[model samples]
Target: MAAEAQGRAPDRGEGRPLRWRRRRSLGLTLLALGLMLLAGWGAFTVSVQRRTEQLRAESNHQLDLFAAAVQGMVRRLEPMPATVQLSTEVQALLRQPGDAARVQAASSYLRRLNAHLGGMQLFVQDQRGIVLAASDPALVGDDLSFRPYFLEALSGRVGRHFAIGVRDGVPGYYVSHPIHDGAKVVGVAVLKIGLEPVDEAWGMLGAPALLADSNQVVILSSRPEWTYTALAELPLERKVDLQVTRLYGDHRITRFPLQVDLRVDEDSQIVEGVLPAGLGASGAQGRSAASRGMLVLGRTLDGTDWRLLMFADLRPVRQQAAQDSLLAGVSAGFVLLLMLLVNQRRRIVQQKLQLNAELEEKVTARTQALSETNARLRKEVREREQAEHTLREAQDELVHAGKMAALGQLATGITHELTQPLGAIRTLSGNAVAFMQRGQLDAVSGNLAIMARLAEQMGAIIEPLKGFARKSKAQPQAARLATAVHNALFLYHQRIRNEQVTVHDATADSPLAAWCDPNRLEQVLINLIGNALDAMREQPQRALWIDAAAQDGRVALRVRDQGPGLDPALRDRVFEPFFSTKSAGGGLGLGLAISRDIAREAGGELEADNHPDGGACFTLWLPPVPHDAVP
Candidate 1:
């Protein structure tokens, strides 16, 4: 009995060992599966992170190239206009007492000047502010007293750049030279350079570039649509936030947000935010996560109301993290399959002892197939992530290209606008100098007063230019639509008279007002009026009718012109930048585009349609102003 009991104990003890072995094997399989998953997840996470960094680096590099190209183009074109003005001034001064013979001789000289200068327009004005001769004969005998350049030159300030304007019904610059006769003021020689040359010049400057006022208002851009926007309008802050949040601070990436202090350095440029540790992850949650990082590139232009900024976005690095997560899932599945195979082999081998070898072989084969499937999935995820990254880069490039093209058109428009006033000022100053030298103190003082008035006008014109060129700040205020329209009309009063375009203003007696920038509203009016004038340029009975009324708790201002009706096809795209029916060299195509944007930003709407009486009509709708507000 003792021997039998001992034998059973041995068998039981052996069974206990087998059970312990089976449990140990299961634990080992699970551990191996967990380790495999952990390793695979780790690798995927690392790979995704690395790829994200690479994509960000590539995006930044592309932005850098764009910035560099824009900088080069701006620098090159910066000095050309000033140089042309200086040369024209010198030549015009050489011809004095610009009488018929002298005027004829000046005309020949201007012709020669135009011939050599290539794309530059030249004209000569006498002391009486009459166009004695012009590179384009069509402008001869035209009175330029109402022009800003005429006023500026008559004031005696030299080498001052004027805001943009229209001359002889065309967009051009008017640079002047004082004709002096033995220290006596006699006449003014003027140059009217068409803006097409400037456009052509900007075209040569690769990449998109914008010449903006100190406030970051786009004065000119390769992209016309951008012209109406100030620096503040751009989602630069948002872009900075995105960059900091996604990229953190990867030195490999460029084009970060920056605060540029123009007063300190003309060539000042900086990248905003320091790179955070752990791929830009800040220790703090929301505070650091805001991602307020940016790259600011800037350059001052001839110490004027102009500055250039180049910026790019960096927010494509988050995709890498998704790839890593996917890889982790793949690795886990693979490990799970391996564990399942081991479990199946053990269960089958124990349950059916005869099939143990065959089942083991089958399990091994299934495990191999699972491994191959995992490998393929991992490859596909990597490939998909890469493709998405590439597509994003391509989209960014395309957007930037579109912006550049628009900026070029804007630059041309600005050049044309500024040239007219500058030319008038130059001629006026030259004549003023000649008069003072001739001992005509009375005339000099008179000219000075004219100059003062012109300066004031220039100041007024610059208000909008500054507003447009400077960064946008929310400066909403109660503005009277009637008063604003009157102010705008005052600026173009002389032009209206000159063009024989009658203006009929019938503003409602009730005070119509809205919260807006007065200067910006005035600009919208100017643009509308300017367009009206252009539309009536060929019309026999030219007229502009302005009617302001209060309706539906809104102030509506309508500007109707007697001219050729607008086409239905053009109406939809009339407000689109660079969409113009005028000749290529005729318009910058931004006036209406910017006007609409301004109107919308001010909670208003600008609409255009053919009037029932045969012409185009532009209506500006604004929210009603309060009854007790000051004008």
Candidate 2:
């Protein structure tokens, strides 16, 4: 445009300006025509997207309301089964589960409830899972053990299940309540509900809808013929199970006629991808290909796996979209006409303006641009000052981090140096005491030889840290039960004799074994034996017994002492951390707590109970290694 104007300005001098004006008018007309077309296309695209979103939202809302109505109707009937279970006659009948005469009266009452409650089949089952009485007399004495509702109620819980009925061969939803004889579950009271009424109500609505169970079978639907249809293909195992149960009688499980896209979830995309051509011409109640494209919205019913599905016809939506496109096109055309008329009038006015007027407009625009550039330069200077201040603060943080790193290094060196010697001293001292009790003076002197190095340990704090750390890569293997018990006694032999404790070992001669960490198991025995010695300090008998035996594919090690038994109120809380009965300063109250954790980590249990004869008994149960699995 600049080259063209420059050439024309020199050729025309200042006399012939009409040709330049005509050229400008032609360029503006073509530009406006292209813009009008682009605007029309954009309007159509936006209208289609908006319509799709509105349809999706509207369908979802309708499905949600339908699901709520269905769930509410079922919930209103929940109280009936609970109320029937509380009747004295029902309870007495269930208590005498074998009495056929007693069930007759119950069956009569159930029949009356069915008549009054608008087509609900009520029944009762005994603990043996046999239907003792039912609203339908023929169902009495039938076995319903395989039903989920019966199984759940027999386990002492309220049961809710939706299944095709095995006994009556009809699809129904079941709700059951357990009938308790004192604290024991005696029988279950069940109510089988037919949702034909909900289906009928849905039929009156404009759109088609259905309610499907977890197995994807339509139990209630707006279209009556659609009932018992499966939404998706069934696995081989599930199909066989249903067939054996005869849940739907002779009706074969088959897929619904509607096709769905697995790649996308939105209703618009799913409807757009349906292939009616695959189902052939006589598919889905004889609906044509265009009519078969349906927008589907599904919602799961609360507290159950059942789903409510709503389908909208895509043909009507497409027709509405077409109308919207035509309206946008007409509007775009009107805008273009208005613009053309305004531009034509402006063209006439511009032709009358002098050349000096155009020069002045250009000068005004250049001045405004220079002022904006100056304002931006000032903002940059302010930003640079703030950045320098931030850099100084970061330098101070770096210095503080350096000091912390040096301090951490010093602490690590101190801890590693101190703990090594303390562990050696503790081990040597235990071995020395064991040798002395055996009357081996030479071995005791040999252990004393380590005393020169033990003094180097000095005094340091031991911290029981509970934080992230590298885990040991040890695997549990079978270990001797007798070895762990004797190790604990050997370590504390001198203390036992000094306290005047008479210790008896039942596992000393017996060959018993367990699957656990040997070191951890010994630690558990030591804590228990030490606690027993302290408990029996004031007792006259002063007896401690260690018993170990194998039973029920496991090893049981028990430690009993003739001391004050555990308090009945504290039995449940004895294994809790820092809950020792010992006086303050007697111990840190962590011995039993730590021992319990060790036993559990080795796949064993540590339990404390009061012995019947009069002392506290602590038992450790460990898993046993199979004879063939021994390494």
Candidate 3:
């Protein structure tokens, strides 16, 4: 009957009896496969949940160990400065200023103290507001009468922390203690330490570290590249609320109490929850290599309205669980098939062959589609690379144009600078012409001499412009750093005087030289000094200082002003092209960017930092010219 049915199927162009049996076998196989898949999924879910818990626990322990190690190091270093400040010998020097022996002894002690503290800057000031001595000799005679520390110590205050003077040429904190002469205030001892150590310590803690006041004004951060000092300047309430919300969402902690709430009148409660483990719907949309399963831990810093967070990937544990479930599902399917093999072996073998043929056809179609997609992707990549190159060239052109525009604006000032000599030359020529017309030979000779002197004066003004106009590829020259600074100052002297900005060149008398393009170095100076003047435009205390020195085989020049310092948020971006905060039409914002490029081309660099007392300082550092390279 089976053969008869098969023959009829072939006659009707339907199929054979074997084909029908294969189809029936395939239906049973599919049902069993579905059951096995469901079982595997169920097992995977439970295993993943348990493994996630384990990973969370392990990650929390690791974070705890990391935090402990960092805290220990910080605590150990903290006491060293306090110990030095409280030394009996340091107190003796503060009480007796005229005792040279004692002052010298204290100075030596202070130097040793600073060295022990890993090169921290230290200061000792008398109660009378006089800087009695310093670890650095340059600061020995500096008056601290206006400093907050001196004033506080004179009032008999105990140890206090304050922010003062830019340390290491950067803004930082000062921990100070009052020196007592019996019951009366005698003087104050202060320690200046860089925040870099704190930042490094935080890195060792396995997370980014930040120090903020109760108000959340990021006073210091280990990740300054990401966080700005302006964060501290924001309204305390806004900073606290926003940061608290983010912290809760990122960490899975259930409950937290806000400490040192500077914003609200009362403390606030915080709660955090963890989402379920799965292939997150939102996560799957992205192309990131990161897995879905993760655990987050968080805790609030004691004595501050700040939170610390840690995150760990749980993908490895989840993957192992999934693999185990897959193996179990395959094993169960094989066992079921074995039990059915006796009755359905022939049918099952035919079904397997038919299924294999369909799968192969689908794979071939998918491969062709993938090849087309890959070709399209390659074409898009090529187009993007071309677009990027074009954009870069356009940016370079814009920068070059902006520089030219700035130079053009300076033309008026340059002309004004030259007018004095030009006017004298005209007068001398007129006199010479009149003498020659009157046939007064001797008088013409005198005028000609005068003309010569005036010609030389005109050359002085033109010389700078000529140097500035020269467009040669950067070449190393044995140039005097001090001379370059002075020349740059001379070009801007009129503007500085008009703006009532004071110029103080603390460069040494002896020439400090470097291997650099003289014109380019001067251009950098011009840009920095000009910016310093502009910064003080609205300030009553307008002062500019151009200080230079040679240190560690480099020539360092610092241009500082009493103007409002750079907004911390904009500091890092200041050197990026066309990133201007100045009013429209005020500048194209290429000055600093170009200056930095020029510095780099000269084998140097430019850096900016906030002054401790509140100002901006731009520093240019260039390698000292090798004696052998000198022309």
Best by lDDT: 2
Compose the digit string of candidate 3's lDDT tens values, residues 1-631. 9999987876666556668879988998898899789778887888888887786666656656654543443333433444554677777776667888877777888888888776457778876666666787667767656555456556765333323353234534455666666677667777765545556565554543445433333444454432333322455575555354331122221111111112221343121224234422223211122235334454444322433444355567778888978987887788777867855788766776879988688779999999999999999999999999999999999999999986774564356445544555676677789989999999999878867755664555444444434532476788887788876676565567778887778764657787887766766777787788878999998888778788777888899999899999889999986677788766667678767877877778999999997899998999998978866
Q: For model 1, how does the per-residue alpha-carbon lDDT over 239-295 read when each residue is reduced to its tens digit?
A: 453344321122122221222333334244422222232233323431232353323
lDDT of 2 by residue, 1-631 (tens): 9999888987767645777778887886687666656665676577656876787777767766776788887766776887777776677788786677778888988899878986568898888778888899988888888787888888988888776666566767788888877788888889988866686678544687777777888777777667777877889998887776555667876777665442334443222233333342235462553254666666767767677777666666556766776676667767877877787779756754655677578768978887898888899888988998899899999999988875564455345334434555677788889999999989889778755434522331122111001123224677787887886786566667777888889988877888876655765786788789889888887989999888777799999999999999988888775577888756645567666766776677899999999999999999897678686
Pairs clashing within candidate 2:
none
In candidate 1, stretches whose alpha carbon ends up further than 4 angstroms from where it belongs are 1-353, 365-498, 505-515, 549-553
The stretch of ten residues in a row with the least summed lDDT in candidate 2 is 460-469
Could you list the CA RMSD of all candidates, in the order they appear? Answer: 37.5, 22.2, 25.3
Off by over 4 Å in 3: 1-473
> Measured by TM-score, how close is model 1 to the native structure?
0.37
Flag the better candidate by TM-score, 2 or 3. 2
- Give the candidate order by descending TM-score: 2, 1, 3
| Candidate 2: regions farther than 4 A off | 1-37, 166-168, 261-282, 285-293, 341-631
Candidate 3's displacement at residue 565, Å, is: 2.3
What are the Cα lDDT values of the candidates?
0.61, 0.72, 0.64
Q: State the local distance difference test value for candidate 1.
A: 0.61
